[model samples]
Target: MNRISARRGGASSPIFARSPAGSKRTRARIRGAALIGSLALAGAAHAELLKFETRPDGPNEAVVATVKLDGTSHDIAGTLAKPAKPAKPPSGAKALLIETQSSDDVKPLALERGLAVLTLDVAKLPDKARAPALRDVLGHLRGALKMKRVLGRAQGSDADAMTDAASAFDGLLLHDANREPAAPTRFIETWGADAYWREKPRVEFANGAPPNGRRFYLAGIAASTTATNCAAPVNARPSAPALRALFAALDEWTAKGVAPPAARAPLDADLAPAQDLKWPKIPGLPAPPEGARRVPKIDADGNEIAGLRLPDVALPVATFTGFNAQKNKKGPPCAAAAAIPFAATKLDREKNLDPRPALVERYGSRAYFVATVRVIADKLVKERLLLQQDADAYVAAARSAPF
Candidate 1:
């Protein structure tokens, strides 16, 4: 549904100087004003109809809801809960989180893990309500860009845009009945994860945007450039390689004039002409060894063991840590209350890497250990697959999520 509105301008009637033309012009103006008013009213009404609403059908079923944003007014539309399945979730199945462009992906991730998964339409946001919802994000970006130059400072412009997009996502999640109904702790954790995932792509795009030489723009471009050039050497294994690869693919796709993976348009099309440039390649690090998998591990099926590897020292530990999960009000009933950690020993002792005693000391247990892990999708996916074998494994591991 589309709504058309009129713009009001105040000016003297120059047409009055003329004769018959003046009378005709006055009639046209009146008609236009009336049309504009009518359209505006209709749009307001439609917006109200689509606002947020929640419905509950049964226990264990997902609640369906929708929220519509109107300038100062939030109207709820409909809410309904999905029914529970006959087969209870796997013993330790907690909440399942899925990222996709459609609902189809949600169902599978939830079913396979025997967990309830919530999906949101991240691409769309209520236009009228966007301002208030995104205020903090804008403020943060503005503040971050004001800092003095530092070697490791995040790029300002790209970071700001990415932050803005993330704030929009948070707004959408705020109204999502599914996310709303979840346990507060679970909801917060999931919200953070979702926001992180949503921001990654936006940040990459923001960085890839042509540089404006402004603090924020330069900050973003710098980060994006570093990720493209030094990803493998700096981060390596499990996810770094893939992260670098995905960005590289986007870079290549932009060069070829095709849509970059799941992106909306050519990478640099909207950026200023001066901002369009290729990322510089890092000088060192040998190309990926042919036919060697980075994070080779047994999959849920066990029959298939496939994973990504970067040159990162923490790759093994991070990969191991991913195999854990936490228990909460939302997931299964376990007396333990918290999930255990699965530490990675192989990567911890690498001579070239910094010694992160914190990783071992904090997460170390007689039975398991924790590796310094950064929470990202590529890592999450690999960890999720490993935990599928035993629901408890996922719960224990999730509790230890490093993010």
Candidate 2:
């Protein structure tokens, strides 16, 4: 019989005392390691497939998706309008533009240009929560689709949320009246030609470090605050054209690395340049507490200030305002601003308190108005701001408008 030696604690035996039950413990340890490894593999596999639900909405496809982040879930809703597949593979990277609100009329335009638009309602993610949620969503998108570039477009309060989440993305196009400072971010505001409210650059970067790396672009449109409501059925504003043009420019910049030129003039509210005039405070509001700021000053002509004047504004069809007082006294302090058509005739001018030059007078006649629109459209197209297809449609719309 072969002699066997076994050690237990400190003592040694020649006839091996049956190996202690610790052998079972060793086996259990091996099994635990294998279990953990399998779980990690399962998690890796699960992460490969993000879930999205598709529903049919007439000719469009509606997507409802739930993205998980930090053990929590966020719901995203969007509409998809995919064009017919091209004969050849698309040349550039497939891009995604995320709108942090309902889908706008511009989605179809993006689809026609070979981009996918996903509109997310981030109401639950307040200003503070948006950054982390956006990061997780973008991460998931990157992993699931292997997307290399993502662009963000948002409006109003949603624009604020995008500012908070700006650093993680390739680019952002913001339409915000109350915009916060961020690096590598573009701010676009629609101001009424008659409103006193103006925006100034609040944040600046040093040495191109934090807050998204020192790339900043700013542009403003002379239009009412409500002008950005491109989806509004009856009160559709001229803002849609400018917004579409901006989007086209951004798309080219992002896809082809061709940056649109910066605004040629000061786009912010630096009232001193316009005139050293002070604005009057509203009567009933309590005197602003200490450290209060004054309202932006307007120019002698009563326009808020000069900005990146879009054709509808630079060329003149109507006067738009950035601010409006609520009609009802009990309502909110300010109502959404609006646009009033420039007087069409002398009689129309006589009825107004302060009438602007009528559109008919400026363009001379309906035929001239159409001709002028065509010229402006051509100029915007040359600047790479307006797509040729959109420019043609815009000209046609102007021709059909009730001048």
Candidate 3:
């Protein structure tokens, strides 16, 4: 949130000023003060709150608190959103504390399930201090905030600290490589096959998942990005369908003692070298990247046959791939994934000599395509992988999608 401050002095740049005297006094300037604004306004009638207190952060809510660590006070900040409740407050007090950079999409998922969503700012601490700081913040959540159980999600980079502090949380989701969790601490690790990197993973997937330690390989999915540097259409499949259901399963496993869905990433065969892959000749498509960097064996479709199939993958529209062609002669490919739409009709497919089936041959019509998406979305929701609202949204977006 921008904390505005009054200024009377002149500066090189244009200064923002606030008018006073019933819209009659535009002053010299107004500026934002880092700690100064917050501290300066301390004790004001509407000063920011403390101890589960909150302030409006634009359209969202920001939970603000000050907690002590090693005799120093640190601002513990995060967006806090509570799920809708009836006349009487919900009997349970639970929350999910996620690192700021962790996916924001999952916040609503936790809220929908009655788990209050909080931010985990302790990851900003130094490596040596993050564990203790996380523990301290979590203690504050459970003790001072009166939350009975506090869950957490963080990126893989924070694994060391989160693992050390795992016992402080009831459940933890880390989007990183596999790691052994401290005993009795529920944990899940996820890697979406591609991170916005141009190069594919240099290593092959292996088995031996830890007890209660689940993993997901978002195969055939491109890393999420807004950049258009690729030679083809960017593939950004809606992760909501996958994540909605995944979060639900995670909640059931952590709160109700149910089992998480079996991990979907199993690369039984070693990755084959780029030169060895028997890629089909698709006219007009860029050549595959040449490197020893291997990939899991793929089916007729570019994606691996196993693992979770998002609606886009389950029902084909175009070849949705996380990998996009690098326009440069020699360097990393575009950071975004690509979605190459199939020909609209069999005649068009033959005209282009495209090996992939035409959209008409595959889906018949746009109406049928949308109906199929609804069916997939509904099934995922039933499996606890997709939320109903999100399912509806998917169907809605499908209606307007270019078939």
State which candidate has the highest lDDT: 3
| TM-scores, one per candidate | 0.22, 0.64, 0.73
lDDT per residue, candidate 1, 1-403, as tens digits? 1111235355321110111346654564443333221112212322221111122434322222223334333322211123245475431322223221233312343344333333332234444433232232222212222211100000123222223333222111111111121111111101110111111212222442122111111000011112222212222112222222232232222223232233112223323221222212212222221221112122221111122222122222321111112123365322111111222342543443423233445456423432223333235344321122232333445455442
Measured over all alpha carbons after superposition, the RMSD of each candidate to the real structure, in angstroms, is 21.8, 14.1, 10.3
Task: Write the candidate numbers in order of decreasing lDDT.
Answer: 3, 2, 1
Candidate 1 lowest-lDDT run of ten = 213-222
lDDT of 2 at 285: 19
Q: After superposition, how far is residue 186 of candidate 1 from its true place, in Å?
A: 8.2
Residues 1-403 of candidate 3 have per-residue lDDT tens digits of: 2222333244222111222333222221111111112111112211211123355666556665554444455565667666676453332445555554546668766765677776656555555556655664565346434576676777655765677677777777766533546658777666654542345453443555677677666656754666545677777776545665676676677777789877776565635555666655566455665555656555665655555676767786776665667666475547777666778888998998888888878788899999999999888777666678878988888887665
How many Å off is the CA of 24 in candidate 1? 64
Please tell me which model should have the higher lDDT, number 2 or number 3.
Answer: 3
Residue 377's lDDT within candidate 1 is 28
TM-score of 1: 0.22
Query: What is the overall TM-score of model 2 with all chains considered together?
Result: 0.64
For 305-333, candidate 2 gives per-residue lDDT tens digits of: 44455555545554444434444556444
Better of 1 and 2 by lDDT: 2
- Whole-model lDDT for model 3 versus the true structure? 0.60
